[model samples]
Target: MWTPNVNTFFQIFLKNFKTRKTDDFSATRNSLCVTIEAVRKFTTKRRKTSVLSKKSKAIGFIIMSAFGFAMMAAFIRLAGDLPFTQKTFFRNLVAVAVAAVVLCREKVGFKWEKGNLPLLIIRATCGTLGIFCNYYAIDHLVLADANILNKMSPFFAIIFSLILLKERASVFQYAAVLAAFGSSMLIIKPGFSSATFPAIIGLLGGMGAGAAYTCVRALSRKGEKSARIVFFFSMFSTLVCVPFMITDYHPMTWGQFFCLIGAGASAALGQFGVTLAYANAPAKEISVFDYTQVIFSAVLGFFLFGQLPDGWSVLGYLLICGISVAVFFYNRNLERKGQ
Candidate 1:
């Protein structure tokens, strides 16, 4: 199983979920898509496994991860009127099926250490709630808005880590976190706004994401491998969601089915790419690169859905991005000074 960074996973998953609406495709496109995805699984595995320069591979992985996630969001949007339960089912089902094959091929054990089982369960549970909140936020808010709120996970992660893991928080980190929260409020603009409720919901979703990611980080420190962590969580997410699947099941058209499949395939590719990217280099070096997802999402929102960020929202985006970049550089400077 993979020792995964669930943030990269959700950042791609939930942000895009709120963006594109999917279209009904012709039979030809559906068939072609299935065929392409079958090939893609093989390609994704080889691509991740192949030898390459670390930075080059990490950058390549991050780019592909963003693109794959963008595609997943488009498919989710295209799924049209499907029950969220059903959609979640298909999204996670496809991801697990593909990721399972990768884990087996990589010779990674799926068995958990009895001692670490609790951590795995906690991580999976948090991850599942994160997904649920992500969908809710996506359904309720504008795509761009939903995504911006979801990205607040990083800020929340710091807090969660400080509280739950008893990790030390730097003064600089606290300041950046405050800036991020302030920026989020600019996007929320709560007074006299109908969006206020969902904005709050979106913030909770971000909290869920942060908690989930912090759990994964703790799990990572327990000497768990990435695939192992991911495999267990994916399986857990699929199984726990079964009741929702049974109770809220909706019949899907072939187009919807294929779109979900495509979404899964894209997520699978992203899962592999992101896992590889961070594995290859220190996160400080490559983590900022993933922020390109915001740009990709902005472009996607505009072209695909005719949506764009408002001026203050754009300023909010800039604030969050600026603080994140600053935090990265500041952390890097600290590391250099310490060295």
Candidate 2:
């Protein structure tokens, strides 16, 4: 609700301190004593934070988003006996509730133009399917493997941007995309195996997410607020899935119900975190940190599920992560040259 800009936040936060002198006596400014030592201490900490730049903040956001999603996935696995549709419904329901609270507090519009209705519906549909498929994959596949497969979204996002946004991809970008696909194939090794199906589904989950995000970008270009987009998506998904959930829902215990709710809460944080990451820095500059989801999932899977990747899977991780990091630096260098 009414998030202030960086300048406004700092200005409001430091106003009283700014008005004080080095020898100002103790006095309450806003229900708390403002002593000279407290002012000096805050100033010292502020000066010590000179090295914390926007890029650092963006990377921090990306890492947080990754971690949040990893925790979400782990919880989804913990609730594996439930239907994917049920899990998706709860996840979006919780997100919608949180978003509703913020929207009501901010008094934001719950309505949009009829023209944007189609795009919003398309976005919500794709996003709902993406979450459904991702949760299914998490239940069927190893947590780390499912996460790695879902990480294909960034590559597919670029591809979707090319097709839907008429964006041009450079040779290096194309190379990285190809390398990511190759590595995904290596990890899946899909032939005459039951694991093949879930791996394929995980890849499709990434595709769905990629398409949904492409729609999100288009919505942003049309000046839609991110909060509004999230709220609409969550509301749409919850409504559409409720009927299906009622028909096929398996009853979950109280513990499972709360875990799924926690998964939903985590998903909301992940969504907000990634949104902030890209808002603060260029996508290329910070997207590499998104891969840390695989790491977090790997650790969680090891302890929670006793899952570990084999030799080929490890190689696949290296290939994908290496290409992603390379792509980031390559784009950064190109930007520098253009400047």
Candidate 3:
């Protein structure tokens, strides 16, 4: 019942102050955690959106590439009865000019990575042969048929990668390759007839292109420049074709000459479009869209040349495209799991 002790009062005040400070610190920490979580969510959503946008752009570029290649095939058909070598020469001539300009602009000079020369020669030889075969198919078969046949290159690429790049394939990849070959037989209708010859040649074209692609992959791994690679292939093809073109020279009408030029330009468009596409996204993500070339070729063939694929050919197309779609999905699934 006497006056309160000063020390007792002071100690009570100090305890209350300590409790208040601790509460404030806990509240602040909770608020900071919440803010961090919100920031993380916002950044994750932005990253997902960015990936989707890039994929969309890649798809668009691939579709453009498909149309360009289809148009190039149509122009080759329109050129009419020209030797495949002659057509190849003109096509490579345009590529050479374009590649030269690119190199000069970049100031990369004409230098190549050492030990790349052999692969370059192989790539050029195979590319030249592939073009010759493809041109022959375009001349002989309907445009859709020729284009679909050439589309077999990706499957052939898998096989070549196994042999040349020492890459191992999954069981699914091997099965897909077999399925693709079976599908090609439906289009080819294997026989000794002259009608089947072009289809066979078209298959060879796909194989050659696959081999050339493998060589290109090897060159790229060795740090070779893409423009230099293109320039070398174009120059090699042009020089090789010169002798054949001179021997089998057939003067072209202005119409035919212009058609060939259109073919060359269209091919360039296709090359650049595909390059842009792969640059933006991985091949597995967008490669399936490349089958659109068959669709474009079909439409062009029907309208321009009044050509229609037979039932067997249509079946082949469906099967091949289905396999591609399946592989594409499988790859996406694996990528998602890895992530």
- Give the candidate number with the greatest TM-score: 2
lDDT string for model 1 (1-339, tens) is 222355544444444444435534554455445545545564554444442344556667766876777777788898887766677777778878877887799887777655889988887787677767777778877765777677676667666776877766666666766676677666556443377887787778778766766676676666777677767777888898899888888888899899888887876776556556545543334444455565566666789889777898688778867876686567556544542
What clash count goes with each model? 12, 0, 0
Q: On residues 52-120, what C-alpha lDDT tens digit does candidate 2 reach at each position?
A: 355567668878988888888888778758888898889889989887887788888888655788888
Give the Å shift of residue 75 in candidate 3: 0.2
The better candidate by lDDT, 1 or 3, is 3
Instruction: Please tell me which model should have the higher lDDT, number 2 or number 3.
Output: 3
Local error of candidate 1 at residue 159 (angstroms): 1.3
What is residue 128's positional error in candidate 1, in angstroms?
0.8
lDDT of 2: 0.73
- Model 1 scores a C-alpha lDDT of 0.68
Clashing pairs in 3: none
Specify the highest-lDDT model's number: 3
Shift in Å, residue 187, candidate 3: 8.0
Quote each prediction's TM-score: 0.68, 0.70, 0.69
The per-residue C-alpha lDDT of model 3 at residue 212 equals 74
Candidate 2, which segments miss by more than 4 Å at Cα?
A: 1-60, 105-107, 138-149, 177-201, 276-288, 306-328
